[model samples]
Target: MADASAGRAGAAEEAGPSIRTLLLLAIPALLIGIASAVVLWLLDLVSGWLESAIWDGLPHAIGITSDNPWWILVVLTFTGFAVGLVVWLVPGHGGPDSATTGLSSPPPPIGTLPSIGIVVLISLAGGVSLGPENPIIAINGALAVAAFARFATKIPPLLIITLATSGTIGALFGTPVAAALVLTGTVAAVRNGGSLWDKLFLPVAAAAAGAETMHLLGGQTIAFHLPPYGTPNPIDFLTGLLVAAFSAGIGILAAFLFPYLHAGFHALRHPVLLTTAGGLLLGLLGIVGGPITLFKGLEQTGELLAHPGDYSAGMLAVFVIVKVVALLVAASSGFRGGRVFPAVFIGVAIGLLGHAVIPGIPLGLAVACGALGIVLVETRDGWIALFLGVALTGDLTLLSTLCVIVLPVWLLVTKAPHFEIEPKHGLARPPTALA
Candidate 1:
């Protein structure tokens, strides 16, 4: 018995970070978390101020509202040209093209951070339809890695990336649970000997700090005031499944169109022209979809929820279609942003449409299922999709249903092409000016 106990102790000690090491790691994790939240908060604050100035102050001064078609066109086109100049003339070319990357792409070189920050702010303030997730994650990850490499030389780069990624996600979602859920599959797949929770310890700690800090900083919450989803029935399940499948199909279709759009835009062969044309198209889309379809879609989601009666079934359908195309264009045309936020908006629109068409489905359930399906396709992570579905509606009753709905949706997208662009030869660089 004594020998067995000693053997077990030895094995356990070898399996994971010791308590002391964990404690040491926790210090930096907390710091990184707090820093990440502050960075996100600052970026949002500046962007919000800029967005207001451009859309409100400038437009009013010019004797036109922001929603005027000409104003939208001019601002968006100029935004593209400005962003293009940054990519063309600025160093590091605003990091890698956002279309070719995902939420967890490798950190860009430290030098690229400035240009990335510039372009992301422009996209946000200019009413581009993409989210800040991808670029912000890249920025934070690169900074964390560089800082740790300089000061804490012993820490691995990959660990820094994980911590920063978790912290940023926590800040974005206003909860550490989001970070944990999003990272579960990746963490579980590692060939490490420690328990999964043990492996998750530092990242979760960072996420917790990030979430709390962001909350203190007055970051907007992701939840909505939708009607509750009560008991589920067989018919509800059938309708929910259909809604989820339909929404996922939309995302899958967008994914199918991604590469072709990316290739066509790249064929323009100059960042200035490609992004300018891209922004022009987005302006046209905005005109058709209205002001509600603009920006990253978070604020727009709130608007849609606050006055559901204002939009008809047809308008809701139009919102879905327009936003999907907008997301494709923004992502494919060298705009620096993430696809997740716009996708969430698309999902919400689809859900509203389903409810309007059926009238029998609960609003909360429809929205949750719709978000689940489209987010699943955009993120390719069941956990994130499930989290967003519940988070957006703030209803736990839909959890089991979403879990079931995600299965078939996952199977449908599992074999489909991902919503990312791959370079035909080697890694595709940002397009430079034509000689």
Candidate 2:
């Protein structure tokens, strides 16, 4: 027994990272962090430039107004054609289905990076109502793996993935803490013989580096100014609970509809035809919802929050409904992007409606709770949902209220199907005899 115990102890000690080893790992992690942030920044810049050229410059130079609905429709439909062509012609089928993917999935082959990057850039530039989180993470992960394999052969691919993802999360949210919060459940679930903090050391280092770099570069976060929550009251708590539950219910409804929508798009059976049709429909939705409802909802969300009084209850309701449909269309219609940004926009609209209806509830609480509800349903992570609520409001006061509201919301969605598409299964075809 003593020999066995000593042997186990020796194994544990060997498994633990030495200080010198940690320092070496931190150098590569920091480099990966900087590289990830730069890639994201470049994507944003390129997408913005392309979107401007397509949506504004082209129309202006051609003596047509982009404001006209017909122009918007034509451009988006053409965008569909372009993306469809790429997907059909490019190997790897334009990467995995975003509808079936999470924020981070297993990276595709290194060879697929170029095609995926092109499609994602086009989608972002063409006003697809999705964020770049998933593809950007995939790109960074793949690149990190390739680079490490070439030079640092001892680094495991899984560790590379974790570092890259952490860096990207930090860059995305403008804070290292966001990565830590998102990764907590994952790290805790691992049965590795180390303390939780010990396991988090490299990831946290990478995240901090990414976040600081983004900060230095003026990265955007989900920030908005809202009236403060003056005091904690039962009335406010009850209102938050009700509002969160209601928004969660809406998210659940979307969850139920997701598969049907995905199948409907896939039923077309070819990337070109399916995407073109999807684009035309998305263009129509853009017309109905106007410019605010068109894109991934990050800038539009800020715009909506900037002028809260400009919208009536009816108008706010329309915004919510239209954005939700647009999000569903974007996700289902072969457009590759993350759903969380649009979901945040929908949650904001819902909160605005709540405030409009019940003037008594604090606006900050209403918005935060609404975000908490929908984000919980969308991401299925309480920490993330709560973080989003607090981040969106730029108020620490919403934290406690949001934490409490998440409990009931989780219960409501615990057994529900996630916002993911199931992988299709089929037997492989036999090879034909050579001529």
Output the TM-score of candidate 1: 0.95
TM-score, candidate number 2: 0.94
Lowest-sum lDDT 10-residue window in model 1: 426-435
Q: Name the runs in model 1 displaced over 4 angstroms.
A: 1-10, 423-435
Question: lDDT, candidate 1, residue 431?
Answer: 19
**Residue 205 CA error for candidate 1 (Å)?**
0.7
**Cα displacement (Å) at residue 302, model 1:** 0.5
TM-score of each: 0.95, 0.94
| Candidate 1, number of clashes | 0
Model 1 residue 46 lDDT score: 92
Model 1 residue 258 lDDT score: 92
Task: Put down candidate 2 lDDT per residue, 137-170, tens digits, no spaces.
Answer: 8889889999999999998888898889889888
Compose the digit string of candidate 1's lDDT tens values, residues 1-435.
Answer: 999999998888648778798899999999999999999999999999999999999999989999999898888888899899999999999988998888777788999999999999999999999999999999999999999999999988788888998899999999999999888877777664677887789989999999999999999888998888888888988899999999999999999999999999999989999999999999999999999999999999999888887889999989998999999999999999999999999999999999999869999999998899989988889999999999999999999888888898899989988988875546634211100
Residue 206 of model 1: what lDDT?
92
Show how many residue pairs clash in every candidate, following the order shown.
0, 0
List lDDT for all candidates, in order: 0.90, 0.83
